[model samples]
Target chain A: MKISNKKQTLAFLKKHFIMQLATSYKDKPAVAVMLYAVDNNFNIYFATHKDSQKSQNLLKNPNASLSIWEHHSALIQASGVVSVVKDAKEQSKIMDRLADAATEDESFWPPVFRIKGDEYIIFKISLSWARILDLEQDTIRQKDTPFTELNFK
Target chain B: MSETKKALIILNDSDPVLGRVCKNKFKKQAGWDTILSSTYDEAIKIIVQKKPGFLITDIILKNSVKDGLDLLKFIRESDDKDIAKMPVIVFTDLGQEPDKKRAFDLGANEYLVKTELRIADVIKRIEKFIS
Candidate 1:
């Protein structure tokens, strides 16, 4: 599965966590953080509180985006729309699978696990499109050959 | 980062265009070596075989019954303690607030947005972390 320029892309994916889930209400911005899981099909999955702000925002407007990035390892980032699942049966199936993959913390249940006896949320983010950026591997200018390429420093 | 570290990328989807972009950023801007991959099954194999200081992976991988996020969970929960604690970076297209929260809740060290993040910026940020 190695691709041509695999170095930077892999670096970007390596040591990062904490995705930014974005939702809006009447054009107002809302953001939240949650645990996420990725499937082999290239789908991003995550869970959250049914009564959370993001849930309310999604209820009003499901249109949203999620950002997963690294502070280090070059400039690798991904953003795209999220498809929210509200069906209890379907959500349960997805969450059950995710729970199996999750750690003890990831698999934990909150007191409000279900609201009105309905709990658990699952979201999938599809790539409207994707981009990869890594500015840390610049080597062309450092060929060690002396050609008067101007250096700012 | 003193421009002294190497970068390894492991992903499930075979996207050369995006891979090139990420390689250029770290190699040219931050001064590091970079490696990329297109699948989680293979990527995890690499991790198990070798110990890399850092990792960049796609949450949504290709050719797997599971995606990159699931890979992260496996690594964290696996019996191999060494890899379970390694720094993990997630490359995904999900930028929503809830999505971000869930990724972290699962155990990803950081998340990157594909579109908004640029090469130079990524390099700078990575440099800051490793440096």
Candidate 2:
């Protein structure tokens, strides 16, 4: 089915806390599974060590892609520009939200919060475009394309 | 007596017309009080003392020891949670994307180009948040 509004996309984002983040630099690409938090504006926030591959890649090139999916249920794919959230207060707030999101899975805690010695930084992904596939609805099964796209730019 | 909420405006230099316009419009239109400060130091002092409902500031402050971006950083980094979380609108003549991005990265709630919008439009934008 067509995702006619932002609320549908936002609801899917809020319902899921984990995403596969893809980043690239110098023609090399890397992907990591991260616990993330979403704001009302569709900005995705996650924390990582300053020296992590993703962080280093983002510092060199801010373009990134992310995907969230559930088994036989739904999927969301998005691309955005990433930027470091340098403000201490803002970082703390985002960390709190990330921690809250992590609570859904008792066995898992966001690694940035647990790691020691190295400084951790928060990054925000401001999504420019996104597409959602809702297998549960199955409204587009007969159509040539089975995705609903939302352009934020 | 009930106290009216206050809105603070920080500008590069003293502009009597802009100050008067904001004060009159905010007070008359929304029953909110408005305070204007032209320096970073003075703005910080007012923020701590008055605890305005929201803030509107320019990017450049000619007379202040620190510029408006510095002031924005200070607010976002304030130890006081209330002050740190206060809504801030960056109203500046700088219309560049980098400036806007910097303001947002610093936690500004809104960014308005001074040349592109009238004072009335700015006030309306502020009202959308405060109301």
Candidate 3:
């Protein structure tokens, strides 16, 4: 999807809290639903159980992808390169930001989600490119709104 | 009520990133406050000042004026009762058999290879000692 404005894209990405993370290793592909927060540079951050299959796969192969969407409106597919956030101070800062984002729903934020220990790992997904599937436009306008490479701030 | 336990992580200043990560993990997962000592002298000073309940160290500390093994020996042989008896866990990339045996012989309560160490496993081991 080609959007003429980058600000509009940023708004769309920030509006969603969940993303479907897709990763593959040695011909096996896995997808997991993850809660993510986007940063100013469009980097996505998420935490996962350290021993989970997705975490293991990412550890083996950092190349991955993420998808976010709403049923009636649009879908955004973005490619990502994963890296572990190993710094304590940086992890604290990111967790605080995430907690602030989920303030409206405290139940969703807990000690488990906090980057406090080894049971979980914090991941930073550096987005390479993204494409939007404008579902409403595809249905109403009667044309495929093809995927586009995201080069926006 | 018992006082809170403190854990100290000793690493090379050149690898501050790992130090920071370990410090965070100990604090967040085990509910322990942590202090970092990057060099041999700094480590000695912090140990004297904080008297940490738990200690974690890497085998090879590049910035350390004295090696990690030396510190382990110092702690075990210290005249101070608390310092001499503190539980120590050695977390390092040195996986050679001799290195492992040496750390264990030097009175390290636990030894972990950084390449194979899992944060969860480390936390569990720490909880066992510090809890």
In terms of lDDT, the best-performing candidate is: 2
Q: List the residue pairs that clash in candidate 3.
A: A116-B28, A116-B29
Better of 1 and 2 by lDDT: 2
DockQ of structure 3: 0.03
Candidate 1 deviant stretches above 4 angstroms:
A1-153, B1-3, B12-14
Question: Best to worst by DockQ, what's the order?
Answer: 3, 1, 2
Candidate 1: lDDT of B13?
Answer: 49
Q: Superposing every Cα of model 1 onto the true structure, what RMSD results?
A: 19.4
Error of 3 at A14 (Å): 8.3
TM-score list, all predictions: 0.43, 0.51, 0.53
**Best-fitting candidate, scored by TM-score:** 3
For A112-148, candidate 1 gives per-residue lDDT tens digits of: 2222322335677654434443333446654443211
Docking class of 2: incorrect
Off by over 4 Å in 3: A1-153, B1-4
Residue B60 CA displacement from its true place in model 3, Å: 0.4
